[model samples]
Target: MIVDDEQPAIELLEKYVSMLPNLEVVATSYSAIEASEILKKESVDLLFLDIQMPLLTGLDFLKNSKNLPKVILTTAYREYAIEGYDLDIVDYLLKPISFERFFKAVQRYYQNSDRKNIISESVPERNHIYVNVNKKNHKVNFDSILYIESLKDYIRIHTSTKSLVVRMNIGSILQELPGSQFVRVHRSYIVSKNKITAYTSTDIEIGTIEIPIGQTYKEIVEDLCRS
Candidate 1:
């Protein structure tokens, strides 16, 4: 989902795709109108949208779209930073985007994504989940998990015996775990309720290990304690 009017800009983004092995480009468009058409046909998890384009600007397109995915704005101009953040965009990458900067922006997406999911609090629960890695899926029992950690577009499920990294987001993974058994305590962490032996305003204890509760998630920690 790279929507830039310039061919070279799009090519640069495509070139970086190899670095993100799990990334899949469903469609690429040179204009907001074309991108809108593609969105109607496919479900995109993330979008790298350009601000300057013909007909409809990237910001205008996003404002009109009913269902928006996690967006990272790629532009040469820096004037739109405040407006971009106001729309809750993942990150704002200045043009001629560097790999290091790109990866950092992506990491920010992972963090904000987990935070958004926790606030939504509508993920359906399940008792078990499948962890797919390198084309094979492994069934994992929820009760065995100590916690789940965010890995950008991936999630690392840490259990009593072993830790497995799957090419999936924590938001989607959280839905697969029983809500009663798992709790998203931080933007980067989801702790198993069964594994927590102690907790405070800022952190939760799972055995001897402690997981920090995100500042934005203070209400969650407080509400859970009251319940």
Candidate 2:
């Protein structure tokens, strides 16, 4: 669950949470009062909470609520670090949070909690993946995928019919794809193994399109040749 007054902050955290296969967002609230209401029905193992909210601050809510689950405080202010730690929060994240910092905070939670098995659990095989685009979930079949390109925080999924610019990172999207069908040929590219029409030491060709291969990924030359 993520609780923040700002919509962008909630969306940013949602994007981060999506990167972790084990983490699932159950709810998001714009205020502490709204979150309190949600807690009555939903059982959340972890809470990504913002310290400064409109009516009720995160610290005030924590003091008032009973049987509160583990918490990780998210705030831009530095003064509240001591107070937040006094509340026994799993971690404190200063905003604009980077993915590396966010990952470390999540690791802290796993180390402190007994639910470590959740991190190691394997995802079941699937032929398609549902990507959220324009506020809707679009079903993208693996067979239709030609290649994927990274655009910083976003990725473009090029398919047989069309392309979609999704708000996802390259590493996260790669985990969602099957290893046998897809390979990361470069830092910004993931190509379908079956779609490769031609290749060389420096690049791979899919149809008329040419995708560069990174120096570190040169081993893929031999791997693809064997495959």
Candidate 3:
């Protein structure tokens, strides 16, 4: 079963699932509410759930539901890896999800389901990240990012010399970034820690650009102050 609010995402996932000979897509839901209701009467083996949704989130729904199946979380956010793993999910996939990454996630799920002896890691290594824009993959170096800004349903990856606007959320792209270099200062902003020239309780200055710090991200600011 696949549960995502975006119809395009659902279609893309369905296309991918069809390629797997051993896998079959049972159902697809656009809302978590619909998925939750379906679960009450359906016996699903695996689930591809989205994180951000109206009314209820995928994480909360999974926690509240009974007889939960093997879940591979498909979301636009990467920050939820620790929390999702704490709930014992099979995998956490970031949005604009590539075929390679998607395949690897499913393979991990299959290995775990069959009780294979293999060590699994939640996040993958990256010296560069490939962003899908205009149906093309743009490769950006890890060291080039100044900051990331969320623009409604899109995100702008501001590099040292250029910027790439991807149809993805800020939370989703943060996964591909080098955590040591990048830090989430606000809900809509993520800055390259190394590029930060100045900062205060409310905002940070990266070169000439000023990015605000969210109220909930005060602890992150405190951590930076201590460091």
- TM-score per prediction, in order, is 0.52, 0.52, 0.52
Among residues 3 or more apart in sequence or in different chains, the pairs in candidate 1 whose N, CA or C atoms overlap within 3 Å are none
Stretches of candidate 2 exceeding 4 Å from the true structure: 117-227
- The total number of steric clashes, by the backbone 3 Å criterion, in model 3 comes to 3
- Please give the range of 10 consecutive residues that has the lowest summed lDDT in model 3: 116-125
> What stretches of model 1 exceed 4 Å from their correct place?
114-227
Over 4 Å off, model 3: 115-227
Scored by lDDT, model 1 comes in at 0.78
Q: What lDDT tens digits, residue by residue, belong to model 2 across residues 1-227?
A: 89999999999999989988899999999999999999999999999999999989999998888898899889987556546754667777878987766776776688567875465533445789999999999999999999999898789999999999998877567646765688777878889989999998889999999999977677855577576
Q: Where does the lowest 10-residue lDDT sum fall in candidate 2?
A: 116-125
Candidate 2 lands at a TM-score of: 0.52
Native-structure RMSD, model 1:
12.7
Q: What lDDT would each prediction earn against the true structure?
A: 0.78, 0.83, 0.79
- Give lDDT for model 3: 0.79
lDDT of each residue in 1-227, candidate 3, tens digit only = 99999999999999987876667888889888999888887878889999998899999998888788999898877667546754667777888898767776776677557555343333455679888989999999988889889897789999998999998767567655555567777778888888889888888898788888888777767687579
Candidate of highest lDDT: 2
Instruction: Report the lDDT of model 3 for residue 219.
Output: 78
